[model samples]
Target: MFVLLITALIKYANVPDDIPARLAAARLPELVPPSSLLYLRVFMLAINLWAIVLKLQMIEDKVIFHSPESQLPRRVEIRLSGFMWCSFFTFQAWALQTFYLAGALASSMSAVYGTPDLGARLPVALWFAFEVSFAVAVLTSFIVKYVLIPRKVQNGASVAGFFGLPDLLMHNCNTLFMALELLFADLPVLLSHFPLAALWGLFYVVFSWGWLARHGVCWYEFLDPSLPKAIVMHSVVLGVLGVFFAIGAALAAGAATISSPYVRIALVLVGVASVARTGLITGIPEPPVGAKKE
Candidate 1:
């Protein structure tokens, strides 16, 4: 499934002739400083890697509790265990974000140290990944906070007790990092990338079906294969992702027009007010544009 994702994405990706110029957008005002931005991404990349691996190590081979179609308690055991990491939307979003951030860092370095041809070649992987990951990250944060966490709380699990450090980081920090990227990276979010984002969500949806057929469990109840409403739920998921992509694109477009770096940062933070409130994630202070490189 993962192979298919890469092949399809690369096979269909459109890399413009001016790709290097587009990828270099972050360096114009040098607003956040590419080194600073890349370091922040590296920080996110490390956290995501550690948290996801830790999550998988704990859940990988264990029998998972069913939270699917039936009115069963979350503790109700079922045939719901296999590749635990692949079973989650948050994990996948984090994975995608991590992958894209890595690619961005490498691409930036290639542009700095490698020839023009080498730099042009690198954005092929990043172009699609950035757009899809951005929307998915945004969608994950919204759903986890407003939907999944609330649902868990309603299920008699104390919010704090239900999640550990890893869960908290993946669900909350993923979107916050993407929001930071939007603010400082100066990467344009093309509305044309909508189809690529949809394809990404669809791949996961289908992969869930395959996993259901093989292991007989779904990590999410709304994606339960046995439920009649599952189709509607799936549609809603894709629809919401589309909405997020559109919003991100609009925000990126508007941010591009603003010449004042402070005002632009304020504009982006306000646009993603939900993620912006976090003390450490979105709330971490952006370095002043003209400050000495850290």
Candidate 2:
């Protein structure tokens, strides 16, 4: 846990270093100095690190490996996960590109050498759109093959009876983590780009939850005796997510105070609400198909 905390903090902390090029290009007035950015950078790094370690440990145990009549499902899972990560990276890249292009245009009088005009923006936007579209498509495939398809053929296993304590713990935890990350990403985008914030937030949550349902968590786990324990564990995870977002909100609020006190408060409120919604998702587990209490 200690290591994970530091990891998240480090990710948050290195923001300045990671986006220096983008910042310079965007010509975004350095409202916050490099020193201030360093602090936030370290904090975000720590948050990310903590999330990574927890997810890695949880998924490592849950991901199954076997040779089956069809390797399609396994391959699809791998592909979906890979595509999600790639989408994240590409989104970051595109944001950086936008900043650089916008900055160059600000400085340049002529539309020739440095400024990225409509021509450049169009291609970058198209690429980002394609990346997002591809991610959504891949995720849909995973749902159809794994979540919606019959599982008995894999090992004569009952889809409803397959999950145990470990499965419940992993499923709930991963869902919570992913939800929070998505929320965090959306918060800034939402605030900066008001019209699209809600749309993006809805898209992310829907896609992620759909993926979970497709992976076989579509049913409730109410019949499972282990449900109580799973609830507790999930609650604990959500609590941690809440803490992380609260801190992030506070930082963002402080940085943006020059604009309006009310605005800062509103931003913080959004952060809090996002965290609460995340907790809500984990509060109940989806039942496995055909579940009956013993």
Candidate 2: tens digits of C-alpha lDDT, residues 1-294: 212332244333322232223321211124433333334334433443443443334322223322233222332223333234322322322233223233323323122234433433333232222222222222222232344223333343333322333222222322232222222221121122221222332343344345444553212121111344644534443343334434433443454444654454455456334322122344423435555421
For model 2, give the 10-residue run with minimal summed lDDT.
186-195
Score candidate 1 by TM-score against the native. 0.79
> Which candidate's lDDT is highest?
1
The TM-scores, one per candidate, come to: 0.79, 0.28
Compared with the true structure, all predictions reach lDDT values of: 0.67, 0.31
Tell me the spans in candidate 2 whose CA falls farther than 4 Å from its real position: 1-33, 59-258, 275-294
Error of 1 at 153 (Å): 1.8
- Name the 10 consecutive residues with the lowest summed lDDT in model 1: 276-285
Q: Which lDDT value does model 1 have at 119?
A: 44
Error of 2 at 137 (Å): 18
Whole-model lDDT for model 1 versus the true structure? 0.67
Q: TM-score for model 2?
A: 0.28
Which tens-of-lDDT digit does each residue in 28-140 have in candidate 1?
34656655665666687788788777776654233445554454333434422334655777778788788777776665565455633334445655666777788988787
